[model samples]
Target: MEKSNQLFNQEQQIIHRLLLNAPFIPSVGLLTGQVGIALAFYTYYRHTECAVYGDFAGELLDNALESLDKSIDIAFSNGLTGIGWGIEYLILKGFVDGCGVEICENIDQKIMESDPRRISDLSLEQGLEGLIHYVLIHISASIKQNVRLPFDSLYLKDLYTVVKQACQEDIPDSFRSLAEIYMDFIEKQEPIDYPLHLFSFIDIVHLDTDKLTDYPLGIKDGLAGLLLKEITNE
Candidate 1:
């Protein structure tokens, strides 16, 4: 168990460093697309290696999956929205798909059985609010890090303006209010409490269990085909 934990932590650190230092190409979608592909391949290799080796392999693979799932939860809880959200989703889905549904499902069920808090019953509205807070936190971090903004230069400003205008036109005030808070944080360079603030808005639970269970049929074959073609051409 100690060895497994060490391995899991090391892998996570490597992934996080890559995600943080990846060059910004001025397109969130493109950046995340590249990241998603790389992450999927890395995850597939790790999962397959463990699956091929029987003995204590199942336990090790389960640890790996659980660690990955927890990382995804932390990302979402920290306001990982937009392209980052999609990338993490693809990484999780692709890894599970590569691992085979039966194995993945058995692990997931075991996780849920052990931790009741692993699933949530939050409303969509509440979830959206959590997402908003997360976005705001990331925007503030971007400003501090001086990384190129993921969206258009004026995207955040434009969103604030549009929301304010909507308020004047008698549209719902909730979103506009949230927008105002985000704008303030961006302008003031205030630090966000991140995962702490995240928990205030949403419970710490995996919300998309059913989606995770499905495994995007044939994805493993698609990945295998690409690998085989590369080998043949090489």
Candidate 2:
């Protein structure tokens, strides 16, 4: 448990640094990737039948999911949609199915049981990644399209490269294939849809303030709060 917390803290610091250097658009995408990592850990810890890693994954997953959902809500409130959803779907699919992890066989059906609005929230969280991909495909879209953006072509390229590396390292071996598929989709200019098939496996739990208070600084009120505030301006 101590070691896990240490590792989580280390990862949080790394992410914080990345966010500081990243442009607003890609920073959101990077945050979405972090959300995916949280969801992946949550799914692996909560839904996996095997108890090989014990309860640590579940605890970490719970906190991570809470942060992720909050981030998604912030994105939705800001009027973003579509691509975020697709990115999240791909991320979840890679984690739950493509990674070669054996999650509950009935996961798809379970997702269908969730509120449709929740599905929308997950999708909207991928806004940054989706927007980036959209620009990449349009070719004629100028960086000046969003005059407020501070990113240049080179910066965007670097952001994508970092995202790819982060996903590869964060996702387990079982899900690496799924991550690769997502990359291929981006490379080939293929359209991405919400991966409805893998939705059932994810169980987004609500965390109360009281519960969050028990978490580490990063999970409790650091990363999630900072990112949400930056994106939402409230």
Q: Write the per-residue lDDT of candidate 1 for residues 52-162, one digit (tens) a residue.
A: 322232333233343444333322222123223323233334442322222233322322232212213222232333344435544444454455444443444554444
TM-score of each: 0.29, 0.23
User: Which residue segments of model 1 deviate by more than 4 Å?
Assistant: 1-131, 166-177, 185-196, 203-234
**Candidate 2 displacement at residue 222 in angstroms:** 23
lDDT top scorer: 1
Q: Which stretches of candidate 2 lie above 4 Å from their native place?
A: 1-156, 167-170, 173-178, 197-201, 204-234
| Per-residue alpha-carbon lDDT of candidate 2 for residues 108-216, written as tens digits (9 for 90 to 100) | 1222233322222113133233333322322212221322222243444444454466464544442344334445545674443323432322233232433433322
Q: Flag clash pairs in model 1.
A: 79-134
Question: What is each predicted model's overall lDDT from 0 to 1?
Answer: 0.34, 0.33
The candidate that wins on TM-score is: 1
Which 10 successive residues of model 2 have the least lDDT summed?
Answer: 99-108
